[model samples]
Target: MFVIDVIPFARFAPAGALSYRFNEYVLPGTIVSVPLRKKTVPGIVVACTSVRDAKESIKTAPFVLRSGAVTTTGILPKSYRIALTKTATYHLLPMGVILREMIPEAFLTHGFPKKLFAGTGHSLSFCEKTYTLRIEEYKKIISCTKGTVLIVVPTAVEIDRFADTFPSAIVVTGALTQKKRLASLKKIKDADIIITTPKYSFIPIPHLAHIIIERESANSYLTVARSPIDTRIAINALAHERSMQTTIGDYPLRMEIRPKPGSALKSISASPIKIFDVRKKITQAPFKALPEQILSIIKSTHEQHGRSAIFAVRRGYASTVICRDCGTSVRTTDGRPLSLITVAGKRVFRSSNGDTVIDAKALCDKCGSWNLIPIGVGVERIAEAVRNNFPNAPLVLFDTNTIRTPRDARSASTKFDIPGTIIVGTEALIPWLNPSNPISLAVVASADSLLALPFWRTRERLARLAFSLTERAEKVAVVTRRPDDAIFTTLENRLDNAFFKEEDSMRKQLNYPPYGHIVTIRIESSITKIEKDTALVQSMLKPKTGIEIPDRYATQNKVVRTIVYKYIDIQKWSDEAQELSQKIYRLPPNITVRIDPESLW
Candidate 1:
């Protein structure tokens, strides 16, 4: 008999591997079916030792070892396994969790085809430009590369776009039907180029050599659902371990991924960015959501039979409702600001979480004041303004609220494609706009509102948004209350170098990203037990470097407390955090640790 150590693919599985008895010797990376508690679960075999060697250890064990059967005959690639281990360690998660997340459940439950290729070359390149220019470079590389080249994009729409460009390339996406996805997975070995979204980028392909990550700055790469895991980081780790050549292309690449000075590809020509001082507009028309200049531009575009786009940072009619009498803001039960949204033509206040809803006429919870006023413009407000100003214009609302599914996105894109149609939306609409068919005009309705977001990368995100707009429109107009803000100067001057230098300096001063790593530990418990739980985490961590303790707040009938740890060396800090995480995992309170979280909140 052989004693095999298995890491069960369960969310709440223990941190360490469990011992299982097997009749045959199983490879370390092979998938096996093991009895975990009352049910069978798929696990990865981490180690194997003969019964003769582990006889004494098994004899002194607390419980009998369960038998595990090999579910998949082929083992995972050694380099891939190492990459997974590094990912687990860096993210402070169990190997099982990493495995469960990285690989599709179908691949684990049912056997997947064995990998047929081993990457042999290592090179990393960065292109800080739009897809219009990047596509040519990608084509050249794809044509020159002998082995199968994997291109990863952020969305299904992008997959479709790339598939159209490379008609012979195999396309894999979650949008595909089960039968189609399975067929695509089976045919990956024969395809020379595979275009896929980040979700299925790990689909084992034969002769895979080059990895091209388009739109590397896309937020979709960093999943925020259950636990945050930056798939970009995981992909980079995998590439490094497998010695695969990597090319990451994005317009204004993320600060963390930006190439060292003078090494990145030259940026493409940008459209003229006109900044309108919204403060002056507000002084002239106190209630006007759309500035006069933007209205005139829309009129001109419509007259010329050209398409126009209006971008808003928020979705609802108003981003927040503030009580004038007591200076109190209307908020949800969880302390999130409430936005006024028009549902079925009736204005109602809804929380950002989209759960709590109240009539617009409702009094403030804290002040009980009827003197409440809506503050900050949103997409709905912008749409309403456009409708009033240009009553005869064809209008399309493009946002998460409107475009929930792929079908909806297609419909929105089709409507926006019509000449003279005005599409109003949030940042979500940027990716759908095609640069080849540039809009006659594009206006950022409220740049200040987007910049007001409390995040370190707000400026970077705004710059990216600006560039994306410039790429898709002939003329981009930004309406900002703070016209003197450095972001506007950067946009007007097209001085990305100056902007990046300033951004880097600020990040270094604040010890954000590139300069340092932050580990966010979120603890949730009853209002009564939250204080104790927070205290326990602080005491246990005892971080020597910078630490932040934000005030605990109530969310969904539970108190949520956040503890942030900032450190320089990832290798040293990750080890210490991993040990502490295991201890905290045993506690009663629900806790989640996120390393290098995309956002502090």
Candidate 2:
């Protein structure tokens, strides 16, 4: 018999390793089925000791050890194990939790296959430019590579696009049926090139040589539902550990991952862009959804038999409702502004968080004023205005409300493909358009609203969004209230490198990403317990120089507090962070930690 230490993959598993007795000697990193309470769960064997060697410890054990059976005799590669450990430590999460997230549930429930390891070579490069150019580069790389290659995209839409481009490549996405997914797994072993989303990036492939990450700046790569884990970081760490060639490509690459010094690529777009100062027009007509210039361009595109698109920052009829008499803006219970949406031809108010819903006909809460006005622009309002002006033109509304499924997105894209058709939508519409065929005209109806978002990377995000639009359209118009903004000036003048320099300078001054690292810790509990929990966390932190603990705030139902840790030097802070992680792991389930959080809010 052997004494085995395993990391169990259970929803509520404990913080550290659990011990069990096994009949056969299970090697470290082997998958095994261990008895966890009344149910059996899959776990990874981390250590093994012979019964004779652990005799003294076993005799003085506090509890009897459960028996476990080996599910797969194959051991995980040393590089993979090291990568997993590093990821868990960096994210301040349990090894079991990180393992459960990385490996597919299907592979865990069933045993891992024997054919997993592959050859590798190490090289890292960046393709910071338009998606069209990125695609061309990818094709060249795929053609030259000798072994199996893996391309990981950020979304399912990209998976479909890549599959269309590479018909012979195997495709894996969460939308796949169980049987289809299983089939793809089997085909991956023989596939020379495989395209998939980040969820299945860990699936084993024979002779895997190169891993490519597309649209590396996308927010979808960071998950926030449980603990935040940046998939890009994990993938890069794994590639580095295994010494495999890796490439990360994005339009106007994010600051943290931008190429070093002189190797950085210029961020110029092929298409021309024009910026319109909309403040004068708004002052003339407060509710004008489209400027005269944009309207003229749309009409000219229709007359010339060309496609056009309008990008709105919001999704509803109005982003907020304000009382005209009292100057009060309607808000949700959590203090978030409410949007007015037209549902079933009835006006309704809803928060972006989806926590509060109310009828729009109600009087203002601050003052019993019945005179309320909708403020700000949204996709629905822009679509309505376009439809009213160009009733004969084929128009498609492409927001979250209209396109709920992949089928809907495909249908909308097909309709927009027709010449003389006008499509109006939010950011969701950007990925659907084919990059090869440039639209005749594209208009950003509300650029200022996007800049108003409460995130530190708003400027960077806006720049990426604008560049993406420019890449897909021959003539692009961005209407902004703040025409003098640095981003606008940079876009209008085609000064890509200048924008990068300015952004880099600002980030360095503020100690943001590429200069410093931030870790956010959140605690959620009842109002009564929140104060006590927050105080305990503060005590543990002990007035550190970089630690910031703000007052507790209320969400929809629970009280929440956040702690932030900012540090510039990894060597100086790593040991302290690791020690803090162990203490945090012992905390109650209500506390969660996020390393390099995407959004402060």
Best by TM-score: 1
lDDT tens digits, residue span 485-505, model 1:
777777887754566677778
lDDT of 2 by residue, 1-601 (tens): 9898888877777756889888878767787777777777777887899999999999999988776444543567777778877777778787766776777655565455555554456789999778888988999889998888899998887788899888999997778987888888878777989998887787777678899999998777876457867878778778877678999898767878886521334655578779988666325444678978788888998999999999988898988899988998987666667899988988799877766788988778778887889988998899888988899999999998888988998878888788799999998888877787889998888888888876787777777788787778988889998987778877776644556677788877777777777877788888788878877776666666335455444575677677777767755555766777777777788987877775654
How far is 408's C-alpha from truth in model 2 (Å)?
2.8
- For lDDT, the strongest prediction is 1
Candidate 1 lowest-lDDT run of ten: 259-268
* Model 1: colliding residue pairs: none
Judged by lDDT against the true structure, how good is candidate 2? Answer: 0.79
Show where candidate 1 strays beyond 4 Å: 1-21, 24-28, 33-43, 46-72, 106-116, 261-267, 281-285, 543-548, 555-557, 570-589
Candidate 1 vs. true structure, TM-score: 0.90
Instruction: Provide the TM-score for each candidate, comma-separated.
Output: 0.90, 0.88
